[model samples]
Target: MAKNTGASKFRKVNVDEYDEENFQDNEDADVGVVGPNENEVSNFLNQSKNVEALKAVLQNPPQGCKDKRLKDKVVQVVVRVLSAFKTSDIEKGVNALDSQSLDTLMKYIYRGFEFPSEGSSATLLSWHEKVYAKGGSGCIIRVLTDRKTL
Candidate 1:
């Protein structure tokens, strides 16, 4: 006979051993602070680099069956692009790009990755084309493409 390791023999999550009492708690964590259980948007307001925060999230993310490196790169690229889009100022957007936005954008597009179903990545490509319109106006046509705003 094999020893039982709390989990079901078939690797399913058996709820029988789970402590119902221990699972009930309400401590909301958000953007380096504790608050009520609500949307965690506080980080968006900060002017600091959000990459560190995102890296922390991926460091111990849920174990999935897919290749982690590919998934991580995809997620990272999306985050960089989205981060650029979120910043309101052109300078800030430009700063975000330095970390890796333009390269990521072209890479994602060239790789034939599917467009994100939600959020900024879905909108950024069009937004960029709009900001820096290449209307074939010729004779030194200037495009006002911003770092992240586009």
Candidate 2:
């Protein structure tokens, strides 16, 4: 909810005529329910973050996740991200990230290429920016590995 703007001069202001359209977009927004335009709202940090996701990556990754480097990278990424949350929080965090970001992680765990162990920092960062922008949980560790920091 919008913060009370300096409170009302008399702690309450009631106008008989209420025009919702006059309010700014967010002003009329409802939490845990609807967006300003009345679209369904999401719980950003809950649904996506789940213990099952980490477990899923470890258990039945896409394919070819057995490479030591790729395994370590995926493990590190999952561990690092999972470390920050209580077991209960994973589902929420996972839900928050966008599909593309999740796909990147899935690729890393399943099919991401090692590529001669040399590549652009920008390339990795760009990959993760998509991940992070969609609110993915992991930090930029794969970025470090791509840069040979591992």
Q: Quick one: best lDDT, which candidate?
A: 2
Give the number of the best model, judged by TM-score: 1
Worst-scoring 10-residue span by lDDT in model 1: 33-42
lDDT of 1 by residue, 1-150 (tens): 998678756777676658786574333323232111112222532445444333332233212224456544545444443444443543334333322333333333333234454554545554344323322222112212322111
| Model 2 C-alpha lDDT per residue in residues 51-143, reported as the tens digit of each score | 444434333332322245544545444433344355445446556555544654534532233432333333344444445655445444443
Quality of model 2 by C-alpha lDDT: 0.40
How do all models score by TM-score?
Answer: 0.28, 0.24
Candidate 1 wrongly placed segments (more than 4 Å) = 1-48, 51-69, 76-84, 95-101, 109-113, 119-122, 130-150
TM-score of 1: 0.28
lDDT of the candidates, in the order given: 0.37, 0.40
